[model samples]
Target: MYIGRFAPSPTGPLHFGSLLAALASFLDARHHQGKWLLRIEDIDPPRSVPAAIHRIPETLSAFGLEWDGEISHQSNHHLRYETALHQLQENQCCYYCTCSRKMVAQRHAGVGYDRFCRTQQHTGGAVRFISSNAELIWHDAIQGKRTHAPASIEDFLLRRRDALWAYHLAVVVDDAAAGITHVVRGYDLIDETAKQILLQQALHYQTPSYAHIPIVTTTNGQKLSKQNLAKPLDLSCVSEQIAAALAFLGHPLPESLLRAAPQAQLRWATEHWSMERIPKRAAMAWPGV
Candidate 1:
């Protein structure tokens, strides 16, 4: 059976954008009769709020999402991350980087990561992973074949000067450990799929099918994010919010049954989910859906 995950960082509550993602992931997993799992992406400890972590599961359950198996937390898996880092280091797939954004900007010109420190044998504080021109070529199940120049991102950081395990590394190891066979997430992260896929291939892991759902955005067209202070999805209107989230993912429900039992509503959704209904575009502005 296929396995999928809805891994959300515990830095914030289940915001509308987050709810959209969870609902999409849940539906995608159920549609395939796959196992659905939840992961608390708490690797960025400094940004992880205490209250938010406690609230995520409650909010998800309020929306009728019950995950399979014990929930996974990235914070608890440092050794696994270290192992991956060592593998990358041993293969000469990564190096130390001392270049700051200002230094990179002045020197790199238009290219993002100029690999100033790729050849340097410097150690401590900063760390980076090599990105071949081959890293630019990756595919998505929904978006089909995709390619991009890695000029803006060459030999990027897997560990910052602060010495934290980067998202790229943590996510790669987490999915492998959890046996995630499918990944359904927002289009904002669709591009990052290539990076994750690169890491999976390097670490000798099976690549999963990916479905990039459109991301919810503000009236100004910016992606709804914590930086914008978009309020969390109101669990008070649990059913309505879930239905709205489903509809945004192109799984509209009949109004007569919008308030029906959560499991029943989910059942109807599973039976009717259509990838074609999922908008092929990126940033989506659902005015009142």
Candidate 2:
């Protein structure tokens, strides 16, 4: 059985870019007759907005992207992350790093981590996974063959110095727990795949198929995101929004279906969804952005 997921952080309300990822994941799962799960990545409470958590699902619902089963939140899975961390520690696959971001940058001239604490017996700091120096490679559903050089990959954080679970660790643990078989997300996340694959290998979890769709960007080459203050998805124009998002994914609905209800548009899209139509690129400028 195919299982796909759309895990988004509740840092802000869903925007046009958010819809792109959600719609892609939803359509791919539906087209394959698989389950689509929603997971709120709220592990970092300081950055999460309480209201956004409630509004994300509401927005997805408004766009007719209903998920299977109850939604899961990262905040509800601390013990699982802790267990995974402990397993890595037991296997001596990770070490505590006392070096701060500034310290690493200053030492390595802005390169990746130098693994200075891997052998220094550091304590009471962030946990860093011992990344392998071998080349990491994988076949992406959309991006085709991808490879990360040994030098490009480095020891990544599993836990933050503030005692917060890192995104990579939490995401890998949650996806494995949910039995996710496929991951449809933005192209910007493609680089993180290697690190996540390493985590899966160390934890003995199955790696899921990945399809990174082109992200929506502005004319000036800025990805549409809350950080860039991308406008919140306009709920009043639900039909148009769905149509636009589907078009961005390379499955533009017919003129008659363009003005259809949100659910109607989604039904048409699902029935005719074609992954091959999606542009094979890292980013696409939004129309009239």
Query: On residues 1-289, what C-alpha lDDT tens digit does candidate 1 reach at each position?
Result: 8899999998887788888778778888888899999999999989998798889998888878899988888889999999999998888888888878998898857756777787778876577877766437656666677777655345657887888889989998989988889898888897677778777877889888888888888666877887678787776777787788777777789988788877778889889987778777787886642
TM-score of 2: 0.98
lDDT of 2 by residue, 67-88 (tens): 9999999999999999999999
Question: For every model shown, what is its TM-score relative to the native structure?
Answer: 0.94, 0.98
**Residue-level error in angstroms, candidate 2, position 60:** 0.8
Model 1: weakest 10-residue lDDT segment is: 148-157
Which residue ranges in model 2 land beyond 4 Å of their true spot?
A: none
Computed on alpha carbons, the lDDT of every model, listed in order, comes to 0.82, 0.92
Could you tell me which residue pairs clash in candidate 1?
A: 112-152
